[model samples]
Target chain A: MIQLRNALDVFTLVMLIVTIVLLIYTMSVMLMQRGKGKTPTNPKVVTKVRCVQNDYSAERDFSKGDYVGLEIGKCPKCGDTLKVEAIYAVGGPKEKDQPL
Target chain B: MDAGSSSDTWYLILLLMFAISFILNFTDIPQRIQLWRFASYIRRRLIQMDEIESDVRRRLINYLGKLNINSPKDVVDNFMNNYFLIEPVDIEPIDIIKRLSHLINVRDTNVKTYAERYMPGIQKSERYNAIVALEIASAINLVNKVLKHYFKLGLKNNNWVLLMQLALEMPNIIRIVNSYSKALDAFFSGTPIGDGAGPLLVRYLVGNSEPKRIAEDTVYYETLINGRRVYAIKAEGPGANVGKPGEAVEKLVDMLGGNVSRIVTVDAALKLEIEDTGEVAEGVGAAIGDIGPEKIGIERAATKYGIPLDAVVIKMSLEEAINTMTKEVYDGVLKAFERVKNTINSVGEGGSIIVIGVGNTVGVL
Candidate 1:
């Protein structure tokens, strides 16, 4: 049965409501951010190899000291040289279309 | 008390509250409050920028220490403070590209001299990497200094608008600096960066053929693609450098005596916000991203020889361009390679085409 005696009571009530709303807003924002999670900081990079003589290509996890123009070995398919075609990082931040 | 008396008290108190608020609004107090909030937020970002700058500086010093520099700190500080370029005037617009080209060359020579001064006997490749690392450190330092200057200015002037603008820009600034930090690792390890797409494609095209030095920090290989003589050019690599590809192309056309049929330039282009990474785009212009010297070099060569110029670009974000090459961009480069071959095939058989891979040639040979 509480009633507003003066403007102070009314002001207190308004502040209480505003504080609750802000708390809820902050909590939801935090939860949303947490759900989004962080993108992979260091993605796994791999090197792709291809045999110039045939339709044979292979990929392996990137090793240190790997460079383009490196001749790995002979290809199994056509027995021609398997050279490193590309070395690139994979699996970073996802595309915008994908849902979190 | 009765409801009537309670209502009267409520009205009186409300009037008092309104008076207080109205008086405060007329004063600078409200703006001061907003200023404080924005200032605190910007202060946090400035601290982050400071940490990043310090970390880069520390890494650079450590790297130089390993290189046996007598005073790594002094050298790094000197480099961070002194490495700058005064762009040539463009108001007259006459031979501006030539002036820019000369300035760029002088800047390159100065940077090389600084690198050699500290590490005299280091391998050229190692020296190139050191120069890249120094540039990165200097860049971070520059960003920190600029931001700090504005931040202090804003606070001193009580300029909330300036502070707010800076606060809004903080995220992108942080993102860019973080990417630069990541690029440091790639450079330190000599890993190929995304910008190397052009050079990587050139290496694929050239195979194991020997490369003749064509220009300062640039090389070219004479090879055949689809029965056409293809002179593949790229910045000399396994080091972090973007050689003067434009000058190389100009010299190459002169050497060939205007016999070149077409010139195709491949480079990494910044993608639109909605564009997918690794998208390949074809256009008509020099693909090189230079102030003026490089792009115009390709253009002048093509114009002089009456050779058609074709540009194939691989799309990537700014961050991706500087960081390690991403799979998406690598695939795009492969696609561009095929596209280049197709463009070359369009020229008559036995015709000559100059393909310039225009990008930072790092970790590619």
Candidate 2:
């Protein structure tokens, strides 16, 4: 009778420990999963442009080889037809020249 | 033994209750989160759609109503005060024409009474003067249209030689009429064309050619600035016509033998902010609409041709963009162009870029 009672007590103690361990593991796993989804990736940035002058002339003459040139025209901000030049072309193999 | 046993049973019940409560709370949290997310998402989309629908509705209604109104002061006042919820940075020329037409036709006693009461305070104002001049121009156009029809009919009946002579001189007559219309349009809109300030530069460059030769005009008159061909096309409209910018682009693309790569369309973007100084924004909305059928036709053609479409928006309040264009009016547009130019160059794609400045340049120099 004494041995049976001691075995029963041991069984209850083991079961309680298992339950505690399971609860802790569950909580930790939930927290880890939550942390993974919190951050976001980078978004695409869009650029804008305006034409300030009707007849904008480049301050410096653009050679055929120049990659980009800015035409000094009008100031969009101050309404001043100032020297505002932009990159007009990419001097590379022309689209027609490229063998498709 | 009895008391201790009872206490243990009570403790067991308490733990069981807590366990049940924990389970319920955890289950409820996810459902609550989902509900909140759905609610917020629906709310946001609803608001955006509402805004777009309202704007479209307002523009359509205003355009339809403009031709019928008779008082310039009333039309201007209503437009300035109420037409748009947000003040535009700049007004489009078409919008100015529509408003001017309405102002000239408005015979409302209430509006006239209001104008009379307020005119003394702002009689010398440039805005006021512009409205007055617009009214005068509207009257002139009405008279001219009637006179032209009558004169043409009378000449047709008078003699065959007269009819032939008139037919030969039709272009000149049209030019004179256009000039008169333009001057009136300029005076009211406050963007005089012949004096050389706004759209006239583009129009003179683009509109000089015969209609058949218009397609080839883009290559010579069009400038390749920042990897883009800035082509200007003029077409008749308060509504979009098939012969406008979109058609011109399609014809140009076909001529290039599918070698055309990317297109960047630029146009006036209406701002909703009342106090926003007309500035240009770069991106998609600029080329979306306002060219009528031409815009839709262009989009279809672009899609059919498998061409990539990009846009640059010049920001202006509708009122400012339409009624008046100052030196800084195209400021936002210029900025957008620079950004797009840089982007295209960076990409290093040797594709043809089309930068279209969309608007009615009726009186703009």
Candidate 3:
């Protein structure tokens, strides 16, 4: 019974320390990003290219994880005159065009 | 005795944690190295993209300079817009004219607009696009080669989750890159892609140059569907074109004197991971593409004319959509044809219908 109690206590202490370390690491990364004045990386950036003259347009509504490239299309604002070019993934994994 | 035992337990636990930390240090060293390597691969792709952009810009300067201009943002912009388009398949001459007409016009307008401001008497020349298209083709090839190299490196690292993620996403990554490569192939060759399927299918099935030029860059062949006079409208093909079926459909309704019975759109659709490639599905509305410009045209025209629109899709992976058309996809098209015939019959015999094929016609006869 005594040995069991000691093992449980050790586990609890180890877990608490782990939690604290993780919390601190995350906080440091966030602080560093703020210091650099860089927007945190977005994983959802998508880039679509189209000729604007044909009324063909792409929509990148800024969904939380989506990043669309060079924002030109037949949207109400971009009109059908501007063609979108490139997209930036901004530090993401396998950032490529996702078909709409 | 109890106090002594407790103290020993605390000491042992402290040592255990320190030992764990020591072990982690060794494991983390390899992971850290892998992270750096992964970063290196990403950096390489970015550099390639940058190099392509620089080369394009340089080429643009040369082209514009030949026209006696220091700068032309509109022409450059237009060039960039069309330059990025990767046509995987060949496009027809008329279809290419149809597909690129907008970009050509925009650039022409830009040139005219800019000529008024910067370099007067700058003629709108097709030669500029031809030269740039070749450059863009090489650029896409380089970029794709880099992306392939980037994804391949992921396999070397076993313990890194990020690398594993990249490996898993490799198929999709290659899919997009392949799309660009194929688009380049189509653009440089001036051939309409298989995505021009709608137009090509109509042309192929219609089997003649006699297809009536119905709309701007659109055409139709008259046939009977279920004993009803069916007018099949698609973009005119034998070239790279997504013929404006939207406008063609509208024209059909006008020719029929309004109150068309039904509209059936046949095109390729993307299949999910769970679905089989080359599968056939029947649904409502535009099964055309993600962009709604064409869909909107069809839907509005259908709604306005009070017609029931049906979409028959030949299932294909996005990879297949951008890559060359596979036998399976072609077979699916054959199957889709049967469905189209059935759809016409089911909608009602002796009723006028319009069948529109939607997709890029890269390698379909």
DockQ per candidate, 2 decimals: 0.43, 0.02, 0.02
**Model 1 Cα lDDT, one tens digit per residue, B1-365:** 56667687778978999988997878888788888999999999989999998999888889889878889999888997786888888788998888888887888899999888888888787789889999999988998999999989999999999998999999899989988987887777677898999999999889878999989889999988779999999999878899989899999999999899899999999998878889999989899888888888889999997999989999998899998898888889889988988898999999999999999887786
lDDT agreement with native, every candidate: 0.87, 0.42, 0.56
* Winner by lDDT: 1
At residue B108, candidate 2 shows an lDDT of 27
Expressed as tens digits, the lDDT of each residue in B155-219 for candidate 3 is 45543665646545554654465455444433333333334435444543453325788775566
Give the Å error, residue B183, model 2: 11
| Candidate ranking (TM-score, best to worst) | 1, 3, 2
For model 1 chain A, the run of ten residues with the poorest summed lDDT: A1-10
TM-score, candidate 3, chain B alone: 0.62
How should the candidates be ordered by DockQ, best one leading?
1, 2, 3
Off by over 4 Å in 3: A1-100, B1-37, B44-78, B81-171, B186-194, B347-349, B362-365
What candidate 2 gets wrong by more than 4 Å, as runs, is: A1-100, B1-220, B226-243, B285-288, B347-349, B363-365
Q: Cα deviation in Å at residue B191, candidate 1? A: 1.2
Residue A17 in candidate 2 has what lDDT?
A: 97
Task: Give DockQ: model 3.
Answer: 0.02
Q: Whose DockQ is higher: candidate 2's or candidate 3's?
A: 2
> Which pairs of residues have clashing backbones in candidate 1?
none
